[model samples]
Target: MAVIDNIHERILATGIAEAGALLDRLGAPGDPLWPSPTWIPMRFDRPLAVGADGGHGPVRYHVTAYEPGRRVEFTFHPRIGLTGTHTAEILPHGPGSCVLRHRLVATSTGKMRLLWPALVRVCHDTVVEHLLDNAEHAVTGTVARPVRYPWRARLAVATESVRLRAVPVPENARLLKAALPHPDLADAYAVRVPPGTSLDPQTWADAIFRNPPPAVTALLRLRNALVAPFGIDRGDASAFDTVARTDRELLLGTDAGHLDFRASILVEPDDDGTTITLSTHATARNRSGRGYLAVVGLFHPPIVRAMARRAARAAVAPRPQASRKVSATR
Candidate 1:
């Protein structure tokens, strides 16, 4: 009920507008989670707390700050009435960067002494910094995948009418992998999706190689497609830019300037098939050069996930084998 307002940093960035749009996804309305689409929802990452009390503890949070492209704040509302406030802010500056700040304020009522390190950090500057760098990537007409949410935060994956995951994968490892050597096409992200719901290996390969779905195009927007939100919605400088390099990495630049993201694809074989990991990273040199800018990663784990499920769906679905023909080669 009381008022608490503060500004964390200055503003600049030629790509501020695009950065704001990305943040808008987090607070967009009518999505099952967040009360509003433009704010942090309560159920965002509650499951990560399971290991704390043998999987039986009160976990609740309320949004105290919800502003598009600026700040997001939340308060802890424990069923047992524990006291504390969690505050978070995303301050965007210049044309291609933003600063992220997170603070926790907790007061004990009676004898609640400190236990853990007051607060712990799973993600912060590293994640948001990646977002800002990708904004520049967006501007240069390149696609850079943001680190996936660790398995713990991932929570669940929904496909039509099914959810999978017997046991949870760790939070830190789930979303963040070491910088992969190359961009991940279909074969690279198999591990990131559900085990085996509906996506087929063959179909998956064709999808990325022949016609990739959302995440593929989202990651490879440099190729140019109307379906890409960041690529198509961006300015002509980024949209029309040609891929200067196509091996080891993809280099993108615009007549206005150079875009700040690059990614490559790496492949490795497994006992059954393969495990592809796509890791995308970004950079911000000077914030003041481009006008104020904000950053957001258009994240859709389940959506990126469905592509995998679709492969499983295709694999198990009825298929005609009579049409199969063999070449004359013995």
Candidate 2:
């Protein structure tokens, strides 16, 4: 068994009551503090209370105590072999100031003993620090310095993102699904859109095509060169025509001598987080088209998945701050 005890705290230049108010809204909609859309959000089956049950991402816990605006405690689910409680509280400091603290006390049993220090601990520490940053930002409107994910933590996140399962073309992707009653090939891939991401499908589509990896660009150039002699369409962005569009979905396609294809980018928002789906429909018009499909199909899924992941990451990345011009005084 491995014992785990972790604590993170921040001193805000605000009264205890003011800091406590931030605590009270922990899992509420448009939450100002749990560091969501960047990290998985904290959620509960219902409004936060003593019996409310939920946890962010893979961790599972249930609320065991609530002190209104001052504090809240959660007990871990036993199935994971994690045993203990975690608490978040606001403590009064000097005049017009208070400290917000989060502490976790737990023991890891079974396989978790090995996993805790190697992987879980890094992610947990990073998450807690981000939470503290959010708390400080909420009270003071800025964080002196925000925590950044270390390379290992970033690797873990990227690994997890690549594992997201392929889902069916959403019903909301009406344009793509309706593009052809019988397409020879239909493929869809999805990724979770972080909180505060642009809701426009156009924005995501642009992100997907913008700044592709050098390897991808090189491969595309090779493909275009190889197909040019066959009298095949280059299938570049310039060849695609907008088939249809809505705030939630953008459909683009191209028609060539051997085949026709449509691609849809859809953004669907729900209670937890937004989902972005990329769906494609292609119809073969001849033997050459069928052969082309057979060859390209092998690479289609991974390419779409990579593009979706890239777009999702772009959506959450912080925008560059605008520079201010200095004035010359007389």
Candidate 3:
């Protein structure tokens, strides 16, 4: 079989959902392909019918589907040995945009394929060019919305009010605190510690404090390391308005059925280790086509003050020894 393989790429910007739907316009060039009317060179007359095996003409299409997100697959057979399938897939990157990938799985099945592969290469090139152009127009039509940061406050959760969640390392806490004035971050963190343990809150506190589980794509990786490990399908700490300040917390929501999902871990440093809080009031749409509160009560306040407390302890721990030295000197 002759393998004349050539691949070209491009990126198109469109809504995550719209990316796939736009392909409906160009459709497939399978069964019912029409000649381009002199009137419209750019547009096709009707939709294509990509069917099983081979179609009536020199080329045939067999459309097979295995979709997870924005993926569509269909194959074409010019002949027995010289046949191939085309795969088109789109993946959302951030907010309003996605990535589309198109690949041709071509193989030679006949004596002709073994004799001359150049002809096979030419055919593949012709079909791929048309598909690429269609993809470009599909994405160009839609405006790509700017990706935004996370929500800032509770009330503005849905309205694009993004709260600043720190995505830095604990090792940088001392450096970050020092940047703040006396009442600010640095020295305070160096001095203060949480109520228990040698752990200094301010100096060591980062917006994200922990990462749990070994999976590279686990929730800890997503939360940016702010919260602890949330068991699979469960938020680290779930919180609801069971009352004003705090109450019953359900990580997974009422409408969240059939699907096993995870939630965010909101926590605040108390005299104890940490208070994990999960929110139930907010709602967000998931990949499963269901809606639930994204988070109801997730919070991790600044801990520079906590570090200040620990630093104070370090100063006072040697008081008895200092007193004996004073008596000896007298």
Give the Å error, residue 192, model 1.
10
> Model-by-model lDDT, in order?
0.33, 0.77, 0.34
The 10-residue segment of model 2 with minimum total lDDT is 321-330
Worst 10 residues of 1 by lDDT: 31-40
Per-residue lDDT tens digits of candidate 3, residues 109-131? 66646533444343334334434
Identify the superior model by TM-score, candidate 1 or candidate 3: 3
Model 2 Cα shift for residue 26 (angstroms): 1.1
Every model's TM-score = 0.29, 0.88, 0.31
Candidate 1 structure quality by residue, lDDT tens digits, 146-232: 333333222211221122222222222222223222212111233322122222322333433344466655655543353243332
Task: Please give the clash total of every predicted structure, in order.
Answer: 41, 1, 30
Which numbered prediction scores highest in lDDT against the true structure? 2
- Stretches of candidate 1 off by over 4 Å are 1-12, 27-60, 79-330
lDDT of 1: 0.33
Please give the lDDT score at residue 15 for candidate 3.
72
